[model samples]
Structure formats: C-alpha cells, structure tokens
Target: MCGSTVERFFRGISEFIFHTKLGVADVQLVDYVSDLMLRFVRVDSLYSLRQSDGMRTKHVVQMISEAERRIGLAKREVYRHVGDFTLFWSGMYPESLSAKKNRGESPDQLIDYCRQGKRAYAIAAEIEGGADRPSSELIHRMSEHFEMCAYGLREVRRHWEEDDDSNGLLTW
Candidate 1:
C-alpha cells in the first residue's frame, strides 16, 4: 500500500511538495502545544498526552518520528551555503542561535529549535536534489520550507520567554 501524503512528504524527499495543508497546520499546532507542555514538570510520555480526537493520534506520532529520523538521515556534515542562506548541521548551530542561548533562553530549548530548522533546510535541499531538473520554482519551494522552520523557531522563542523557570536568561 502507498504511504499517506504526509508520510510521503517526510520520507519521499524528491516528491515532497511543500503544500499548505491540514497536515502542516495540525503538526504546527501539535508541535507548538508539545513545546509548551514540555515546560511543565514531566509526568507522562508524549504518546500518552490526551487525544481529544483519537483517530489521528497514532498518525501524529508516526509522522513526527519519521520526520525526525529523516532529518537525521538528511543532515549534512559540512556547513552548506546556498546563496545567502547558510544552513548548519545539528551539532553546529548558527550565530543567531548562540545569541539566543546567551541572552537567556535555555540551552535545551534553543537547541531543539535549531534542530527543527536544520531538519527543514535539510529536507528542502534533499527535495531540490531529487528533482528531475533544477528550476527557480524548486528553489522558491525550498526557501518557503526554510521560512516555515524560522516561523517555528519564533514560536519556540516566545515559549521560552514566557516560562517562569527562565531566570537571568530574559534578555530581549
């Protein structure tokens, strides 16, 4: 049987079209909520979180896990610069990320956020490489994916700012 579109979106890099759809929206909300929930004292596993609409629960977990795995697979060893966009690998982050951690954000929080962005850029590059032929459209789509990762980063930044546990790390 064929994989779900969202699964293909994660696993089948070449064919993954970055469409603004229900999967993207739901994953954003779910991830954002998960980020927020993580700030609290941990009491349960992510899979144990209450499933209001239980139907898609398994799919959500599977999707995230697969994406994370794919991101790891797609991660690059050397820093790649595409035009003005400089993409960093998992262990190596950008200066902006360092500034965030230095300002007051928890290292863990910023690390996770950077990793997410890395995943986005890596997947975008993978798709572009797998394309039949290079086109401006492909570049545009990759840039859009990169921007989506930035958007997610901003969300996590806000979450970090609001946490009561944040001590001196509140330099805005």
Candidate 2:
C-alpha cells in the first residue's frame, strides 16, 4: 500500500485499540503520538511557509491546500481522542464528593482510561508520518494538527484535574 494509505490504516487500528479494552499499553501510545504530533507541527510549519514563497513559480498551490487539509484532519482526530479520554476519566468520579464519599474509583481505572486515549494518539502520529511530499502543504497540515493537539491536551488535563479533585469543571 502507499505510505499515506498504510499510515491511515495503522491510525485506524490505533483508534480502535484506544476505544477498546486495551490497558496500559495505550498510555505508551499516547505519549508517542504526543511527541510526534509536536515534532510534525514544528517541521511542517517551517517547511510549508518556505514552500509557499516559491508557489508562484512552482505552481504548487494545490499541494499546499492538500497539506492544510491533512493538518486539519489530523488535528481533529487528536482532539477527539483527547476529549474522549477526558470524558471517560470524568465519568469515574463525583462532581462534589463529600469527604466521606470521596473514596472514588481506584487509580487503575484512571490509568486504563488514559492508556486507551494514548493509543488513539499513537495512531494519529503514525499517519502523520505518511506525508512524504516534503512541500508546504504537508507543513501546513502539521502545524494545524499541532495546534489542535495542544488545545485538546489542555482540555484533557483540565478534565483530569477536576475529576481527581471534584472541582466539577469536567463534569458532564
């Protein structure tokens, strides 16, 4: 299969694993994806801007557009993964547990939720690596994805903190 297609397939598998009953393995996947997403965003931003400068002569506007699309798609995927993970964790605790009612679920449950989310992230990172065009298009998409991931991560972190401390910020 083509690199892009292969990447997509792997990404889908990762998403599946995250949504499934995977365990701590998913956390490792998320960490991997997070690092890759950051790297792709940085590299793609610089690359796309540089390539855009020569678009007049290279007539590569289409390429740039495609790259932007890829970035947008990737970003959305990452956001969804993070959001889902946050929600899952939030469901395990109370919005305002009294000291007597604050026992909450075990740490293992929280870890499992995080692991599944991370697995989904790993898939996205793998697909992001499929862009071999090395043009401005790829860079633009990476930058977009990076921004989305950043936002999603913050949201996820907030949810985790609120859930753990019964702050109600992440309550549904």
Best by TM-score: 1
Q: Tens digits of per-residue lDDT for model 2 on 115-163?
A: 3344434434444434442223333333334433334444444444656
Q: Where in model 2 is the C-alpha error above 4 Å?
A: 1-24, 36-49, 54-156, 159-172
Question: Which residue pairs in model 2 clash with each other?
Answer: 27-115, 30-118, 44-139, 48-136, 67-137, 71-141
What lDDT tens digits, residue by residue, belong to model 1 across residues 1-172?
A: 3655433323322112112321354333233223323322132332232233442222222333334444322322111121112222121234554665587643333344434444444454454334343333433343455545444434444444554356634333
Model 1 misplaced regions, further than 4 Å: 1-23, 26-143, 165-172
Full-model lDDT for every candidate: 0.34, 0.37
Number of clashing residue pairs in every model?
1, 6
TM-score of each: 0.24, 0.21
Error of 1 at 49 (Å): 36
Tell me how candidate 1 scores on lDDT: 0.34
